[model samples]
Target: MPRTPQPRTAVLASADLSFRTRVREALTGLRWEVQEAQGGAEALAYLEARPCEAMIVDTWLPDLEIQEFLAECEKRHPQTDLIAVDDPGPERGPERTQARSPRRNEVLLALRRGQDADHEPQGDGASWNGMPEMTPVHDRTVVREEIFVRGTAVVEATRPGAEPGPGTVRLPELIGEAPAMLEVSRRIRLVAPRAATVLVQGPTGSGKELVARAIHRLSPRANRRLVALNCAAIPDTLLEAELFGHTRGAFTGAVQGRIGRIEAADGGTLFLDEIGEMPLALQAKLLRFLETGEVQRIGDNDPIRVDVRIVAATHRSLAEMVKAGSFRADLYYRLAVFLIRTPGLGERPEDLPLLVERLLARMAEQAPVRRLSAEAMERLRQHAWPGNVRELQHVLERAAILAAESPEIGAAEIEFGETF
Candidate 1:
């Protein structure tokens, strides 16, 4: 009898999740078992532990110098073939080429397929790629102490506005340097890629939606739709229909048959905002869907299976509500599998300046960017932010309007909103 060949192992090293995903998909039927590494160091360590047939390194590595890393690999792991992906830009390419591998042509073909797929149109006719091209991770960056998990790496931000380095995943929307803020970033990176249900708890206007969006963007479902529903915004009578689909004649409207938010978010992320506001009766049905991954229409007997990640956010305390018999204990446990709390503005006062800069820059699209005078900044520092980041945004908007034609906002332009 003829001998059977074992599948070849390949190591993929890159900080870009989308790139890794595309490459992995391209190699699906190529008899290759691909292992992932977020940086050069991890790749080296992984190769040391287990010999592989080939290793494909990204153009840039987050932890180690690219040229140095390639040299080290050449010297230490001569038995393994090395292939490096081209840089995203046209001006520069991989620093050095490695000796040709037996399967170099096949691997290069797969890399081309992955690269082409990245630039092609995705779902909903949207040209947006899964993730923005991240700034290259340099080897000389300083490591900041872990803000939350022991193993998580957080590179210190070199400037006021800087991109996160290798092994650290920070969304551009999440802007803050406080320990609490960093902890939130750490937790998001940890849970975003998984199928786990995440419960984001925090005070009102503390950027819970931002956290939810971040989770969706970083997850495997990034290319799909991110369906969101504000549980508290809809009336109790219509909320059920909004969540679970209803047949044309299921209810009084009977105008048309339509799917609910859950079904719409199939193979994507379903963001339920203000989840605590959902009525207890409706919570039972939601729990069933979460448990079974099957949702039934209001008047239909057949249930539809869906694959989705749930990211629920709430301003109210579900634990307290459960204690008071207002929320279901079982549902609470299911949703709270991975808890992420967004920090209030008061908790991270040092981030106020950065927040102000970001908000002002956003507002600049409508009008000229206005600078805050020394006294105006002082006044902002003095007031207590009762409404959290939302209130700050409102205050800045008002000040920007009040400043009008002026290039800078003065103390008189600053105004505080009433506490709720």
Candidate 2:
């Protein structure tokens, strides 16, 4: 049998005439349905009333701080994929700085792979495909010696449908040499640059948000904001207004006009966490947004424009939900452009020591460094982490606080949970 055609995607962006025109043209070429939002309050209302596979947001809105908007989104609808954008200039401030250069060698390594020489440096002022030349590096010795640093390259230049490298995020302190984690890092590297919708499926506390953040940090849109929303935390009735903004007097509590999450995150990423819990009625609306990048606010006639990318996560089996008719199949197809499954802690037992050590180091920044005993390490490996990394962090934090008097934490200090 022939394969079915894919559903269209929604592109939410700002009302700036030129910007909106450019976005519509770009997405139209990709066969995506485009939606428009004027600002944060307007975008949120539209998203709540209509659903989209993914979204694009701008960081610097006329109203509302982009980070604060993402926080609200995390609290309201967690399953939507959010991409944030910002002015490409240097005025983005501290948050932009932290996210921009997540890993120093990522770009350099990507360029190096295209070179012909094993250790030979590309000539100074070397340019690629008409793009500006990369920063000139003079140290040949360092380049030769550091070429094969511990891990394999997480990304590759193979065409689509090729075997993907490990698709996971790699944090500086996240230990473990497990193949699963390596694969996750590879996926992050591959998808970060492209504007595809990403579906991150994993159990709660499994670092789904962390993976999402890693993608944004490494992506072309890193300088922009990364907005996150949680689907389960917010009530159904209020969810629409929260996602797509409302005009003044649209509803009972309409003291003033409001901008939604979708509009607020234009020009960046919008992360929707815990998407499986989204209500059925909202699913259809979301499907509409994904199909057409236009959003009609509650009691409003005009549709605003916005630009964003979507990265969604969930622990539940959406397939089951689709069968039960709780989730929309069309929406599922749009969001699953690239799916990444995060391995549970139990699946990567070898990483326990590394995880513990890193957590301890982070804690030490606030207090003193503490060590974990062999017995404790063994127990951690043996036990099942149902809550995954989030659970592990909590346990370590508690243990650290309790072991403040001692330099080391033993198995006795560890609180064990039930097996999965």
* TM-score against truth, every candidate: 0.73, 0.62
Regions of model 2 farther than 4 Å from truth: 1-175, 417-420
**4: Cα error in model 1, Å:** 4.6
Task: Write down the lDDT that model 2 would get.
Answer: 0.63
After aligning candidate 1 to the native by TM-score, how far in Å is the CA of 231 from where it should be?
Answer: 0.4
Query: Model 1 Cα displacement at 283 (Å)?
Result: 0.7
Residue 385 Cα positional deviation in candidate 1, in Å, after optimal superposition = 0.7
lDDT by residue (285-320, candidate 2, tens digit) is 766776676666777889877777889999998888
**Per-residue lDDT of model 1, residues 70-166, tens digit only:** 7778878887878767533223654344454677666777788777755567565543323334323232222222122211234431211334333
Which whole-number lDDT from 0 to 100 does residue 232 have in model 1? 91
